[model samples]
Target chain A: MTEEIIIAGFGGQGVLSMGKILAYSGIMQDQEVSWMPSYGPEMRGGTANVTVILSDERISSPYLKIVDTAIILNQQSMDKFEESVKPGGVLIYDPNGITAHPTRTDIKIYQIEGTKLASEMGNKKIFNMIILGGYLKVKPVVKLENVIEGLKKSISERYHNLIPLNVEAITMGMNNIVPYKIEKHVFQN
Target chain B: MSELKLMKGNEALAEAAIRAGVDGYFGYPITPQTEIIEYLMTERPELRTGMVVLQAESEIAAINMVYGAASTGKKAMTSSSSPGISLKLEGISYLAGAELPAVIVNVVRGGPGLGTIQPSQADYFQSVKGGGHGDYKLYVLAPASVQEMADFVEDAFDIAFKYLAPVLILSDGLIGQMMEKVILKPQKPRMTNEELIEKNGSWATTGKKGRERNIITSLDLQSEKMEARVHRLMKKYEQMEKEDLRFEKINCDDAEYLIVAYGSSARISQKAVELARAKGIKLGLLRPITLFPFPKQALFELADQVKGILSVELNAGQMVEDVRLSVEFKVPVEHFGRTGGIIHTPEEILEALEQKIIKNGSIRHHKTRKSSIL
Candidate 1:
């Protein structure tokens, strides 16, 4: 099976690292993977996005125009990628700071209050892991164990002690994601 | 032993250089290729393999440093984007003239000058057609994946040393910046001074202890001697065409149309091939691994089999000229691409193939295809 995923958010939101973790998790599972980032000066506090493709066969293109899933975390990304998600695909987003929520009925939508959830968890840095967790809950594309292993590879040795906390955050993400019948567009923030 | 690792193309190239036993790496930072030097510095190959990694004052300084290291029969390399590469071209010409062995990587960005930091293949002409002003050709390799980005370091160094000439890894920022799972080889030991003597004693400045001092220079004032040198360079290029030329053919056996691209464009066209085939169109891809010793002969051979050829690049239309020349204009070879770092999508490629190759191949074919589409 092939899963072409696009992760987009603000630069500080760990969008790239989230894609990296997902890609590494794919590798851990013996899947072929590629990660291509939309990079530039725009990566500095501006909107950033990365396309991560995981496939059983050789992946042809790293960056894709259409994708199976779009994990959007901001309004700019929602505006850009909501239409690009393949019909009957999945879109997961953090409801925080998003003024315009996804409106694509053809694709499934899920929401997680990643920023508020991470704040509740007492670590805002794990916001991306929360989004990732929410995504995994919806699709189960990769396993929790592999994502933990993938995290070990992406984060430095000094952060090894933080894995349990990150894992907790991920579990929180997975547990809290709700399917989008919540016409409640913005976050409860 | 080899191990699988997720790595960006630039970082993989750096790690591969260390694993390849590259003696020294001199470079100036530039996007999106700064990761090469960043990885080198952070990984500290100097501590790991006794390799020297230095950030020179400028691109020119870095290339000249590579020149110095290479002239002494050391495996040396430098990497930069388009503008920085242009800065190094004069030194590159000098390296070619001096017949030094070194690996230069151009992680090209969009440019006629100071262009965008986004990826581009616009440097195709600058690379394969000899960017440096001289009667010389760099042994050029284009890598479509991170694996090849890592593997070609050793291969480029080998070719450079084998021919006592500069070799270039012509990568764009797309391949340089993208990450993929790559199987990395273990570190090999560096060539000992004795081995260097054995391999390059004829000309390398390896301290003339047992033999006469060898002088390395690209300048010989006599016109006939310079002519002979040019002829010798030509012979090396011809030899490269015959021996070192490399390419990959995907689904070409029964293909009615061909997409000829290299590096990232080839990777994109591979998907285009799949898209076209699913739609009942017979399309294939021809990926040139070596841009200088291009897949000219292969394209010429495919010309007889395919109805038309689409030369897809990330530039305006540089390599299409080479493609046309390769097929000798016998087939309708058209160019399709985007410039200023906008990567063409696979669907765009399929559309271009239908509109430019299948439809434009002939008026009758165009009408038939148009009716089918409608």
Candidate 2:
């Protein structure tokens, strides 16, 4: 199976690192993966995004016009990437700063209050991990063990003590995701 | 041997150079390629392997430093993006004229000037056709993957030392910035000064001990002497073209149309080839690994079998001229490209192939076969 995922958020939201962790997890599973970030001066305090592709076979073209999944964290990203998700695909968003909700009915939508939960947990840095956990809850593309191993590889040795907290945050996110169902009557008329 | 690790192309290149026993690295920071020097500095190769890494004040100074190190019979390298590479042309020409063995990497960005930091192959003509003055050719290797970005460092150094000429690793920001898994080679120690003196003593200046004073200069005032030197250089280039031509052919056995590209463009066109083939159109890809000693002879032979050829690139149109020259006008050769760091999608490339090359009906049998496939 192949999953083309786009993760977009503000610069300080760890969007690029989240995609990198997922790519490392794919490697742990002996799968081919590529991580390409939108790099430049604009990445500082601006909208940062990354495209990560995990496939059983060799991946071609790291850049894609359409993605199977979009992990959006901000309203700008929600508005920009809503139409780019493939039909019948999945879209996960954190209802933290998103003012405009996704309106696409053909795709599946889920919301996790990752920022609020992370604030409640007393550590705001684990926000991306929570969002990632929400994604894996709906579609378990990779095992939790591999993600833990991925965190070990991606994070530095000095930060090893924080893994348990990050793991707890991930579990909380997985348990708290709310499926956003669209009413049929809205489009029926 | 080291275990596989996920790394960016720039980082892998720096690590491979250190592992390949390079004596020194001198470079100035440039966009999309600054990671190479950053990795080197962070690793502190000087402490581990006695390898010297220096950040020069400018690209010109960096290349001159490479020239000085290479003159001492040491393996040295430098890397830069397009605008910085332009500043290095004069030193590069001097290196070629002096027949120095060194490696240079161009992580190409969009430019005729300081255009953009995005990836581009617009330097194809400038790189392969001799960017500097005079008639000299650099052994140009184009890497499409991060694995090759790591592996080609050793290969480029080997070829540079074997031929005693400068070699270039031609890549773009796409390959420079993207991350992938790479299996790194085992560490090798740098050569000692005595080894350099013994191996390259015939031409190298190693204190002129126990021999006539050896001189290294590209200047020859006599007309006939310069003419003979040019002829010798031409002969070496001819030999390299014959023995060092490298390319890859995919699904070409039964292909009716061929796509020619290199580096990142090759990776994109590979997807387009797969898409076209899935729709029952017989399309194939020809990727040239060495852009200088280009796979011209192979393209000439393949031109006889394919009905048409389309050249795709990130530049406006540079390598297409080489492709057309290779085919010698026997087949319908067309060009499609995007410039100024804009990359073309696979669907757009497929559409271009269908509209410009396939639907032109220049090949009599292809029109009927196309109808059956569609």
Candidate 3:
């Protein structure tokens, strides 16, 4: 099985790092994976996105036209990626900066209060981890144990002390994500 | 077995260079490839392996430093992106003319000028056809994966020393920036002065101790002498063409159409091949690993079997020329590409194949082929 996902948001929101950690987790699980980022000037304070693919077999292209999941963290990302997600795939987003919510009926949509939860936990940097937690709770592509091990590898030794707090944020996100229901009658009409 | 670690292609290349016993590295920082030097500096290979790492003031200075170190028969390398590599062309020409063994890496980006910082295969003509002035050739290797990026450094050095010519690791920004698992090789010890003398005693200037002084220069003013030297260089290149051409052929046994690409383009074409096959189109992919000693024979043989060929690239149409030349009109060959750093997707390539090549039904004509060949 292969899971091709795009995680996009503002530059400082740890979008790239979150994908990196997930890719590392895939490696720890003895799976083939690839992490490709949209580099250059777009990564500087603008919208940044990464394509992360985890597969049981070798990954063909690191770039994809359509993905299994779209983890949108901002309104621009939502507007850009809503149509790119495969039908029946998942779209996870943080309701913080998004005014225009995803209105697609063919796919499942879920929202996590990532920014609010992170701010409430006294650390805004854990926002990405919270979203990641919500993703894992919905898909369960990788185990939580491997995610912690991945965190240990991606985070430096000096920042190891913050692992517990990040884990707490993830747990809270996994429990708090709410399903985004679209009225079927309106779409059918 | 070496342990597998997830690393960016640039970082893997840096680590592999150290483990491959590179005696020195001199490079100027360039985007997409800057991580190579950054990782080397952070690792501080000098402390562990006695290797020297220096950031030159400019790309010109960097390639010249590589030339200097290589003159002493040391394993040396320099890396930069397309624009920065343009600055080192003069030094590259000098190294090729002098027959010095060195590794030069170009993590290419879009360009005819200082184009976008996005990935591109536009350097194919420049790298494989010799960017610098002179009738010279550098063995060019295009790596598609982070693993190959790490593995090819050692291979490039080995081939460079064996042929006494410069070897280029021609990669692009996508491969340089992507992260994947790599199995690093065991560290090899740097050669001592005595070992260097023993290996390159005839050509290298190793202190000239109790022997005739060895001189290295590419400036033979005598017309006949220079012609003779050019013949010798051409002979070496011919040998490489015969013996060192490397490529991979996927799903070609019963394939009706062939897609040719290298480096990142090849990776994407592989997906296109699969997509076409799923649609029952009987498509396959042929990836040339060595761009210079280009697997021309393999392509020619495949062309005989396949109904048509499509050359997909990240440039306007560079490698397509080589593909056309290799097929020699035995089959219809078409080109599909995206320029200015925009990478084409598999779906796009597949669409192009269906619209341009497959549906066209082999528009066989000798007139255009004759004109192109001439």
Candidate 4:
């Protein structure tokens, strides 16, 4: 299956990190994957986004205009990507930050309180994992176990203590998700 | 035998150059490409190979140093960004005129001037179309990843020596900065003065012996000899075009549309292929591993099969000209790119393909076929 995902938010919102974690997990599962980030001046306070493509065949490009799924962590990201998601694509957003709702009825969306849930778990940094966890629950693209392994390998030696909380946040986020179906739009040939 | 380790494109190139037995590295500091000299400095690979590593005062001086080292029959290399490379063009043209063997790595950044320190493939025309003056061509290798970045060094050096011409490794900041697993080969030194003399001691300037005084010069006072020299260079270039054309093709046999791109742009175009496939469009990618010996024949062969061609690049439309030249206005050649350090996303490329290739499929068949002759 072709899974084109974009993880976007402010610089410190862990958008790029979440994209990397997912890409790393895809690599571990032996899936052809590519992780490309938005660079140049746009990377400063601007929205940082990464397009992660995981497929069974070789990935040619890591860029995407219309993503199959988008994980938006802030209002800016939601506003930026609302029109770009495919007609039947899924959007997972942080309800506390993403104030704008999508206009399309065919698309599936999950409004997650990732920051609040991670804060309740006693850490603000685990918010990305919480979002990732919500993403995992719906897509089930990569195994949760593989993602955990990928996270352990990615974290630095100085921040190894944060691993447990992040994993806990992921499990918490996954458990809180409610499944919904996306209507498939048919295009006439 | 060697082991694979994670390496950035710039670092891998440095390591590979050392293994290929480069005589010296003369370069100035530039973003993205800085890691190349840094790798040589940190790893001290030069010390192991008895190679000289000099961080020059400027890109101009570094290229001049390359010219000098190459003149001595030493395998020298230099690297810089787009602006920095622009500074070195005069020196590069001189090296080309002198028929010297050197490797110049342009870790491209956006430009015309002091552009941002971000990855870009905008120097396509400057690289392939004689960046400086005079009718000359430098063998250019466009690598798409860290692996090819390393692998191309040996081939680049070999081609340079074989043709007695300068070679360029055209990569962008992403290839320089991004990390990936790479395999390191054992060091293989280029032919020595003694070896060269033994092979063709009569021609090289290993201090002329009891024989006639030896002079190595690109200039000849006699116009007839100068014209002959030009013809010889042209003959060499033609031979190179025939022998050294390298490219990577995806499912082009059944492809309705083809994406023609090189280096980092090619990698991004690969993603566009899948996006198109999912949308039920039969697309393929033609990635050029060698930029200069433009694979005219390959694209010409596919002209009848593929409906249209998408020339994806980091610049506005540098390689687009070459694509047009190859196809000869046969297929509808459209361009999709980002400039001034703005990298084109896969989605943008997909949109362009949708508009130009998929929607305009009929246009490809309606257009007159370009000539196959080179």
Leading candidate by TM-score: 3
Model 4, position B12, has a per-residue lDDT of 89
Off by over 4 Å in 2: A183-189, B361-374
In the order shown, the candidates' DockQ scores are: 0.78, 0.73, 0.86, 0.33
Off by over 4 Å in 3: A183-189, B363-374
Q: What order do you get sorting by DockQ, best first?
A: 3, 1, 2, 4
| Rank list by TM-score | 3, 1, 2, 4
User: Candidate 1, residues A27-77: lDDT per residue as tens digits?
Assistant: 889999999998878755799999999999999988678899999989999
Residue-level lDDT of model 1, residues B1-374, one tens digit each, is 89899999999999999999999999999999999999999998878889999999999999999989988888999999999999999999999988899999999999888989999999999998889898899999999999999999999988997788899999998999999999999889998888988988889899988799998888989999999988888888889888899999999999999999999999999999999999999999999999989888889999999999999999999999999999997688899999998999998999999998898788755666699899
- TM-score of the B chain in each candidate versus the native B chain: 0.96, 0.96, 0.97, 0.94
What is the C-alpha lDDT profile of model 4 across B205-279, one tens digit per residue? 666767775555666779898788788778878988999989999878789889998988988888778778888
Q: Is the docking of candidate 1 incorrect, acceptable, medium or high quality?
A: medium
The candidate maximizing lDDT is 3
Weakest 10 consecutive residues, lDDT, candidate 3 chain A? A180-189
Query: What TM-score, to 2 decimals, does candidate 4 have?
Result: 0.80
Candidate 3 C-alpha lDDT tens digits along B45-123 = 9998999999999999999999999999999999999999999999999999999999999999999899989999999
Better of 2 and 4 by TM-score: 2
How displaced is residue B238 in candidate 3, in Å? 1.0
Report the C-alpha displacement of residue A162, candidate 1, in angstroms. 1.0
> What is the TM-score of chain A, computed separately for every candidate?
0.94, 0.94, 0.95, 0.88
